[model samples]
Target chain A: MGKKIVLTSGKGGVGKTTVTANLGIALSMLSKKVALVDGDIGLNNLDVVMMVENKIVYDIGDIAEGRCRTKQALIQDDCFPSLFTLPSAKTMDNSRIPPRVFVSIVNELNQDFDYVLIDCPAGIDEGFHRAVAGADEALVVTTPHISAVRDADKVVSLLSTYCMKAVGLVVNRLKGNLVTEGATMDAPDIAKLLRVPLKGAIPEDEEINLSSQISKCKDKSSARLAYLLLASYVDGKDTKVFDCASDYRGFFKKLQRVFR
Target chain B: MLKNNTILRLKRILLSDKVNMPSGLIQLLKKDLLKLFDSYFDIKEESLKIEIDSNADGEYDVSIKGVSERIKSPRFMR
Candidate 1:
């Protein structure tokens, strides 16, 4: 079986889908066969972000219901050969498929792919329960807000109850300027509150939003860099956490400060 | 904003990667305990302290003080 990972957060609109899409792409770029599963059920957006919204004919619900085979539902990415997506059903509600069935599907997919990344739905409801079922690890996504952090704390406590060994955090849509200006919580604050080891922090990048909307890829953007670093870390490569506060300040200025 | 920042910074330093009980939960527990023993004794919510020891063995100790005269009398126990 392959690595089954669930990316989840308790709060909504915190970019869970965005992280799932880009991280799948990033993992594929590292030469791993990746299957991105959209676990949001009725409100699927991973396919849209991957630019394969029009390509999905069969979804996870179809396979779960025995209407189609797993391979029949898998959508191959046009840009990344190693990447595939199991889009969630738009018509079905979150509770239509049982959590046990979702676990079995992930277990089956794990045999074929190197990484099965489940893009979990927001909230601590049935959708979230189904998303994290039978996953090998979890990536708890959160923003720098107090509510998001509190929600993440709840999720982390849940993960602990499930006895999941590997759990890390990814702070998304972080603005360095906001942190420096005292308008936002820093990464350390989030890590402390969430009680998880820090995995990566995705900087607030305008290009990521633009690219997702226009369906045109951009190069070496902040989000891309963050995703790449996250993928490398997941692949067991040693990578430093991106220092948003210092990185926003030019590298030369940071270097000068270090030397001085 | 500066005050908020300072509070956040202090929280980051003091409570990093630690799960402390939320104040709301503490208050709720206090309220429930007060209601349970309201007739026998006066439960002082403000004087109750819940502490978890940091040693190898995970043990929690709850200390409640400020008992009323009725509960303090030796004849009341037996």
Candidate 2:
């Protein structure tokens, strides 16, 4: 059995799905058997983000309700041979899932995969509870915004209450310009506010949205680098914290040399 | 109910912590408050006071006087 990790945020649109998709790809690239479980029932987006929407014949709701076997709901990624997806049902409401059922599902996945990554829906509601029920650890995703940080704090508290073995944070959509201008929160600030160790930070990247929308993950974009670093951390590797300003400087320096 | 121990632990962590309401909730509250008092006042939702400042004396004071145009400054005759 492998570790089960839930990626969650209390606020919506903080890139939980994006993190889950890219992390699955990154882990699979490292030769790990990874499964991304979409826990956002009635509003499934992981499949779309992963560009496997048409391949999903069954979903988590089906398995939870005994409509289909758990294995029957698993969808393999077209791009990565080791990556799989257990998509959430777009038609079913989140209330249909009992906490025990979700836990059982995660335990079953743990038996077959190196990692079971649950992409939780936003809010501290039933979906959030179901997503984290059987996880070995959690990654609380937040943005630089104060509201997102506050919600992330609540999530950290909830995870602590459950006595989860490991709970780290991933701050997504960070703007380097804003951080330098002192107009936005930085990784250290978020870590202090949430009182959790930082897993990784993803800078604001337009390419992430573009690539995901086009179903392409081959781009060596900042978002991809962020995901790779996050996966490396999860796999017990110590990747340095991404310094966005320094990264920009190196990129521009290389560009200038190339042009010269 | 959250247990006494849990509450105490939460108090230790959250004591004197001031959490501002989300912009969405703040907007909704401003709209509701305006609707309730719209007959007598004009209100600016963005300027509305939504935070309660906690003092070292353990007393929290909520200021809502700055939210509306109806609130007038005390006139002083020089």
Candidate 3:
């Protein structure tokens, strides 16, 4: 069976879906068959991030209601044939989907893909419970902001109750210049505060914000590199963390920073 | 300077009892426990109290205190 990992953030708008989409594609780039499942239910939008929203016909609700086969609901990525996404129901209520049903769906996906990445909805409510029902591991995503890190701390404590096989952290939207100038918390420090191992740290990049509209990030973007590094770690190949502050540390960069 | 302040504030927030215990959740837990314990013991609903604490390792330490006047008959046990 493949590994089932849920990407979650206790607070919303922390780039959980973006990380799921990009990480899924990166895993596919590594030649691993990956599945992305949107667990957001009524507010589902992983399809939009993956740029397969138009192709989705049968959603997770359809599969649970026996209206469609599991394979019928999975939409293959156009750019990466190895990556497939199962979109959540845009109209279905989250409470209507039982945790066991989501578990079974993820179990089914595990048989076909090397990695099953579930994009968890924000907050520790019914949606959160259902999203994490079948996962062996969790990746908590947070920004460098204090509020985001505080929410992440609560999430880490809650995940401990779930007895997850492993819990990792992904720090997103890290402003490199702010960290180098001591204006904001560092990504690794946030991970340390949450007591979760740092799996990835993505520097703040406009490419990521644009990737949502364009369906894929530029190949040369630093966000893409960080995601690839994260994927390599997930694949058990490497442990090198991306240096988010590297660009702003040099003497010449400091001069540029003054003008920036 | 700002990062250090953030770290200090986060430590205080994480260490606070409100964040760790969440009184509202504990109330709900007590309600359920009351129902379960009432099956075998003659105890008042308000008699149950639960305390939860997280240590340095992030592990929860939970303790429940209650008083029961007597146990129900074996025939009534469920």
Superposed model 2: Cα runs more than 4 Å off? A213-219, A248-260, B1-78
Which runs of model 1 end up more than 4 angstroms from their true locations?
A: A213-217, A250-260, B1-78
Task: Give, for candidate 1 chain A, the lowest lDDT window spanning 10 residues.
Answer: A212-221
Shift of residue A231 alpha carbon in model 3, Å: 0.6
On DockQ, the stronger of 1 and 3 is 3
**Model 2 chain A: which ten-residue window has the lowest total lDDT?**
A212-221
Cα deviation of A253, candidate 1, in Å: 5.0
By TM-score, who's the top model here?
3
Second chain TM-score, each model: 0.45, 0.39, 0.65
Tens-digit lDDT string for candidate 1 (A114-198):
9999999888888888888868799999988767776787789788877675999999889977777667777766786556888
lDDT (10s digit) by residue, model 3, range A119-159: 99999999999998889999999998778888888888889
User: Mind giving the per-residue lDDT tens digits that candidate 2 earns over A9-36?
Assistant: 8999998998888888889988999999
Cα-based TM-score, every candidate: 0.77, 0.74, 0.80
Q: Tell me how far the alpha carbon of residue A50 in candidate 2 is from the true structure, in angstroms, after superposition.
A: 1.1
For the candidates in turn, chain A alone yields TM-scores of: 0.92, 0.92, 0.95
Q: What is the DockQ ranking, best to worst?
A: 3, 1, 2
Ranking by TM-score: 3, 1, 2
Please report how far candidate 1 places residue A158 from its true position, in Å: 0.7
